[model samples]
Target: MPSQATTAPRVALVTGTSSGIGAAVVEHFCKLGHQVLAVDFNPAGKAVAGKAGAVFYEADLSDPDACRGAVTEAVKRFGSVDILVNNAGIQHVASIETFPEEKWHQIIDLMLTAPFLLTQAAWPHMRKKGWGRIVNVASIHAQVASPGKAAYTSAKHGMIGLTKTAALEGGEQGITANAVCPAYVKTPLVDNQIADQAKLNNMDEQDVVEKIMLKQAAIKRLIEPEEVAQLIAYLASDAAGAVTGSSFNIDLGWTAH
Candidate 1:
């Protein structure tokens, strides 16, 4: 990265900031002097974001109105929303044949549509300023597929399309949109997956980590949340001004194959 520029600190709205990649992002941006509005449905996120020096807004992204309202709060409280990070997500791991239709809707609503609505809400402010950044925290599943992650893979793939479309529309306005695709990370979500996969596959937790989780990656370890956060901070910075409409992977070589 280039020497940090002396740009004015931005007003940022970040979703999913209660834990995992979201929490890490809140910490990183606060450390960089940006005023962050951390939004999460989890009330626990309130204290987490507060500790990171960010204002907290508890809103469930799955509700379309909540997405818009979160952005509204950011602009209402702070002057403008210079950056939006859509990182809230959940997962279910049943085979498509047995996948719950409700689970599909829930995942899609939160991961794909909410980002679009939040972007819609934030677009005008960004247009007014002639500068903005939108980063979607997608997954390696955006590029590749696996058994029993139908809804997850679908939402991630849709995210790339949403990001590219936003980039095309925002290109001339100095607003860049992109997605960061990370593989399995050491997050509470992944911890749940470890336990779930063990039960689903009739394997021990260690066996699931080695055989199911790390089997496809050349680097056989879970990614740290901070690793993903670092990449996101760079993408949101002026340093990546020309990098948009693309998916940057920190997938432990999972997609290299």
Candidate 2:
């Protein structure tokens, strides 16, 4: 029913489809009648893609070659990649003084570099089509910083830069590049953060949620994955043709102050 009103079905290559924001994006695009190629390291992603009628490609984006291969596989199977959702991410929480070097490279590769690689691989196809949409799932961390998130903040910040750069390059073509930056959301990643923050802050998980997480947020709650998915769907739609080179914050006012 939701798929009935689309201009035509296009292919969307979405990373991190195992769960959370990535999973929600897959569902949204499918409802909008697009063919989705779901990429994730987790095997669970296969089932998620199957249920959503998306093709699944399991990949660890830390490897640069894999990022290129993912786009190629999508093109091979679907003909073109009209939309790219660079939503894959992992978090590492620790003071910069105590962060591991390997973890830094790993986080940076997956969050920041992989998006660029995937976008590069998908560029020619979009150029051929004369239209494309790229939605990078950045975070409030992309705009602001937190105490124990050195690696995460750095990678997310880079994502914003990548989004802007992509926008400038894609402008001449009909491709638009944008980012959806959300505040803390209820996902396994955030749940892990809740637990880690409690230990790091010497508080219970509930205190971390109430005091730390919501302290700067006006909404006083975690954002839902569907809420983010809706925005991604919009950016990937024709309605958002002029919305490129922008970072839209769904941060619940975390950055307002």
lDDT (tens digit, per residue) of candidate 1 on 120-193: 99999999999999999999999998788899999999999999999999999999999999989999988888
lDDT of each: 0.91, 0.91
Error in Å for residue 68 of model 2: 0.7
Best-fitting candidate, scored by lDDT: 1
Q: What are the per-residue Cα lDDT tens digits for candidate 2 across 166-211? A: 9999999999999999999888889888877887788888899889
Task: After the best TM-score superposition of candidate 1, give how far the Cα of residue 128 lies from its true spot, in angstroms.
Answer: 0.6
Candidate 1 runs further than 4 Å off: 1-7
How does model 2 score by TM-score?
Answer: 0.96
What TM-score does candidate 1 reach?
A: 0.96
Q: Name the regions of candidate 2 deviating beyond 4 angstroms.
A: 1-7
By summed lDDT, which 10 consecutive residues of candidate 1 come out lowest? 1-10
RMSD of 1: 1.4
